[model samples]
Target: MDERKYNMAEEVKVFSTWSSPFALRVIWALKLKGVEFDTIHEDLSSKSPLLLQYNPIHKMVPVLVHNGKVICESLVILEYIDETWKQSPLLPEDPHQKANARFWAKFGDDKVSSIWSDVLMKEGKEQEEGVSASMENLKYLEEEIRGKKFFGGETIGLADIALGWLAYHLVIFEETLGLKLIDQEKFPSLAAWEQEFANAPIIRENWPDRDKLANLFGVLREANLGKGTPK
Candidate 1:
């Protein structure tokens, strides 16, 4: 908390939604930095005026407002938070290591968006193919883990926070879609990482109500499959 940047009069706020992995990333980063902020939950069905004003182009949840300046995009916000608050640094001090962390962070996000999202909406042969590809994508992360406590070496950092969605979304996908996203028997390290990351105190405390989120995903799954209501 740099005194110049941490003004007592300034207010920090995040335009968020209940089930947004992106929004939650911003929240987790803030908590990690020990920054006090308020979350204004948004109904995506009806986009709020402020949210639109803050993020005119994307009009998405996770529009972070600090003082009067607005920040959009989760990954960008994570970098911003890291720069603003120096304590418990998110990226490494070594330039080469920091660059590597950024690379993997983007890789994880790309895989999650491309592989997992496609698999979520697929079924039958297509779904099988998607799941197989997803597994292959995760193997890169498995190799990256390489017996380390986290991607950040010791504690959670940029790559860990960026990929934290797997800790929850994979679980949700497995439960709702009945697809095997992570197999502990094969990818022991990734499985262990997910369990530890999901249950970590800060992450766990901010988790959305699973019952509600699971029901939501179940409904989405049914819709994607062109089926009747979920059981």
Candidate 2:
């Protein structure tokens, strides 16, 4: 009759790298769910055997091993967690709402990385296009979250977790690139939502150190600039 005994049967292992936005996606989901997990930090420079074994395709970190079964791809892993544990609901019960949330999540996932390219590597037309795309994506998000506290509507859900990568990781790009994509006056809704997200204890406590993340961005930017990979 003890719930604690039942909880012990469900355990998870997360393999992640420190500087990966994709890895942070899984971390935020786990933290939001209040799920106790064993975290193994992987050195991306030298791939771990365990990581390679779990994710033979991409072999990337942010691999969630639940009850000995491995789930890769941060978004997919999040869906798996939500389906497995219903304690802290990450997705909506309504099918329509869930679909809408997934749309925004996909938008952010696909377009947000381009902002990094804009900030770090490309110049001239390529950089301009990246900036334009980033702005358009933010505009869509602002419209979507106009009256809602979170992307999933009212409560922090999977979409919020997916887009939360921007909350911390973007500051560095903003600084390094000298771009201010989110203007409070221009996008008041998003600005307010960002504050709400940061104030949330789960998110606040889990964010990467700003200075450190910024330094990493600087290094990556320099490398990408040299290689001309921004486009």
Candidate 3:
């Protein structure tokens, strides 16, 4: 009566969008577990029937369809993947340590989302305020990961997966906005962590194309803030 065992005949499919950090979390988690899964690239503007059927409430990408069962939300999917596969453990063994990892993961999601909605989408004073808030969030994380190579420890783990966007996508934000959000002087530790995270073999291989992300963010910034016209 092993909960982790699944029939080999069952299909493992992930409905995801290429540019979504949320979907990337699922991809990273599955890859870390060495779980082979088929990916279905989804168009968020006009989502597919399968995505809608699998995730009726949110109908978002990163919907993991295991056999016929569906799991939504990136963090939830990460935990499920970890539990299902015992290799390359994502969460710590100790209960207290596990809770700490979960806490940081949740914090990373909140801060990243805030930067998107408040900083990237706003202008002038409001954007300035958002930047300040984002800095504070990064500072807290910088202090947390000062001694450790990664959030969970020496190896990539749940918190690292949660904060993966900061390592790659944050550059797109800085480039598109023409502002320095996480600089060496301000967030030295977090800046270093970004490099380390991006350079990891698995992450380096799977990271989204930089030029494409830059173009996408540039278009999004123009649409939201009416900044430089998107090329």
Candidate 4:
């Protein structure tokens, strides 16, 4: 591990929502860095003043408040945590390897929203187009994972952490959207990656219950589809 940027702080505080994939990213990063922090669960429906104050721009959850300084954006917070507490280390030691990891991390961050929007937004021609684009992105990722157990190599690292949200949360999106985007036969690498991602002790233990998340997704889909009173 490289020298830490921030030391001497006894504890850190994180503001987040349990069901959010963005929040899960922060949780995974902190856990990987072996950082002990207090978690403040926020209600998205009723945003707290502190949450708004911490993230004035987006007012979103998954804000990291470390030593009284607030940091918004999940990916940015992950990098901050990595730089501040370099114990286990999220990024690689080599500069080139770190660049490679950051590249995939950026790709996942940039394209995942479109994938979710396409999967959860519409049907017919629009959905078909979305699925096609989503598959293309997934294909690139599958090739990236061709020979490695995880994105960072033999172990999970920044790229895996960035992409981790999709591993568990995507099932809800797929079921709700009725899209077969990641068929096991078609994308066996990512299929296997998802199982490994979900099985990580920190990930498995920290995630929102699958049934609960599925119910939430069902509600969102029904609301979007204008039927069933959002189940």
**TM-score per candidate, chains pooled:** 0.93, 0.92, 0.92, 0.91
Q: How close is candidate 2 to the true structure, as a TM-score?
A: 0.92
Clashes of each: 0, 0, 0, 0
Instruction: Please state the error at residue 223 of candidate 1 in Å.
Output: 2.0
For candidate 4, what's the RMSD? 2.9
Candidates ranked by lDDT? 3, 1, 4, 2
Candidate 3 lDDT over 80-107, as tens digits, reads 8899788899999999999999999999
Residue 34 Cα positional deviation in candidate 1, in Å, after optimal superposition: 0.8
Rate residue 53 of model 1 by lDDT. Answer: 93
- Runs off by more than 4 Å, candidate 1: 1-8, 228-231
Question: Candidate 4: where is the Cα deviation over 4 Å?
Answer: 1-9, 228-231
Looking at model 2, report the run of 10 residues with the lowest lDDT sum: 222-231
Where does model 2 exceed 4 Å of error?
1-5, 227-231
Better-scoring candidate (TM-score), 3 or 4 = 3
Clashing pairs in 2: none
In model 3, how large is the Cα lDDT of residue 146? 89
The residue-by-residue lDDT of candidate 4 on 1-231, one tens digit each, is 222334324558889887888888898888777677889999898999999888889989789988888889888888898888767788899999999999999999898568766767667788788888888899999999987788988788888988987787887667766667777999899888888888989878888888898888877766776775743
Clashing pairs in 4: none
lDDT of candidate 2 over 143-176, digit per residue (tens): 9889989887777898888888677677567877
Residue-level lDDT of model 1, residues 1-231, one tens digit each, is 565367455688999999999899999998987788888999998898899899999999898898889999999999998998788799999999999999999998877566555788788788888878888888899999879878898899999999998888768768887656677887888888888889889999998888898888778777767885644
Question: lDDT of each model, Cα atoms only?
Answer: 0.85, 0.81, 0.87, 0.82
**Count of backbone collisions within predicted model 2:** 0
lDDT of 2 at 69: 94
